[model samples]
Target chain A: MLLSRMVPTGFNDLRREMDRLFQDWMPGDGNFFRPSVFPAVNVWESGDTLYAEAEIPGVTMEDIEVSVVGDELSIKGTRKPMPEGDYTFHRQERGTGEFCRFVTLPMPVNAEKVEAVLKDGVLSITLPKAEEAKPKKINVRTS
Target chain B: MTTATAVEKREGKVRPEPTRGGRIYSPNVDILENREELLLLADVPGARPEDINIQYENGELTIHARVDSRTEVGEAQFLACEYGVGDFHRSFQLGESIDNSKIHAKVKDGVLTVHLPKTEAVKPRKIAVKTA
Candidate 1:
């Protein structure tokens, strides 16, 4: 079947047209509203460890690199392009390319203890708080 | 300049049926068509393979994936909350007829691929010209 003939001109097409217009008007990269960062990240802290998560579908562990230096965490990866063939695209939305994101942690972390895991296309990093950065309990005595 | 903006978040349509209690997101997808079949690829991170459900009925294909909460809200203090963790739901209306028995799907690295083969009647045929 000629599936491309059945492609619908829906809201997504309209949105794409609007984006193209805005991009054409601003060719010098001077626009005030920048696009959102890639690999949108979510970070949280629990107990003495901080966690960061990113959704990176279709990315393999071999192509991903995670590192922590002092208070900065960096994630870098590349998504390979689909194999070339005789297929015709009806709708293209997912992106494929190299992406890198750097996030500054709120507190100093033990870089030696940082751990990262990739599961089900989600990357989760655990950063343990540095000894000096952790909250300490002070002793109370009767005066 | 290698960095590109992530896919925009589109909330899934609210369904009348009861849910397991979490926001519903519409996963980004790409559709491709060849002479043999139509291919659909959807990005659904954090969803287990067994939790995905696909249905084709009335010239419409629907995809739903249930995702378990990764972290408890009361336990962790969010420092930067940019994306939500929840289930995914999306549906597409198909205008061409497909061979129901030949349809198949697979998931790997959080991406789901569904292949819908066209019926024999719709497949393109080549005719030869001969001299009389």
Candidate 2:
């Protein structure tokens, strides 16, 4: 009875809405049950650089993968479940599975200059914008 | 307290209580019992090792973890937010068979593991069978 109630009633509804949004934004069936993004990430941009951080607990640096292709940055990793044993679980809310998140950068970035780091199970990525992509100020000349 | 009535007592003390002013979220955890000890595994993502606190008193074991706030990046805007960060709090009742003084805790990769050892007298022991 407790387990049944623990499942949020609005979860499926939110999943459906997210599926629709993902379908229009990216090409795919947008399966909501098995989401493409796990270990939710935050992405933001500055003047000449973009930053992305992902919360991935129980994952090592070796398992985390970060790459920049064109204006898109992708983060991929897997969270393996606990070891098999004869232990009874009291409460298990965390899900374990492979996840990949693809984010489109707002500005063009230099892929070669991208830096990624994983510390305390959180992955941070920095992408520097290409020289030509940086905003330039133009001064008007008075004749 | 081994009967069905004991269940009510356990549930009564497990209610979530907010700490101070910030929002308090219950951390996901797994409890395992063996012949020697009870192991508690909790998922407290984004919490630094130094921020986790464990306390035991009067047969009650509690965990308090303060997750560090997100790093501040200048002019950064969140595009999508699926997980909200907050402090974690949870408490469990330990029976008399447990040795509270020997409990140990450690955090790694954002996971906290607590070990609660059973008292020597409470451990299962083999009794000799003899013909009278």
Using all chains and alpha carbons, the TM-scores for the candidates as numbered come to 0.83, 0.74
lDDT of 1 by residue, A1-143 (tens): 00001111243345445656786676653222323466888899999999999888889999999998889999999877664667777666577888888999999999999999999999999899999999999999999
Q: In model 1, what lDDT does residue A61 have?
A: 97
What does candidate 2's lDDT look like per residue over A3-79, in tens digits?
00111213433554675579776655655354345656677776678778777777888777888899898988877
Please, what are the lDDT tens digits per residue for candidate 1 over residues B36-122?
Answer: 887889888888889999987765678888888899769899999777787777777664467878889998888899998988887
- Candidate 2: residue A62 Cα off by (Å): 1.6
Backbone clashes for every candidate come to: 0, 0
Pairs clashing within candidate 2: none
By TM-score, who's the top model here?
1
lDDT of each: 0.75, 0.69
List runs of model 1 lying over 4 Å from the truth.
A1-35, B1-18, B130-132
* Ten contiguous residues with the weakest lDDT in model 1 chain B: B1-10
Candidate 1 chain A: minimum summed lDDT over ten consecutive residues — where?
A1-10
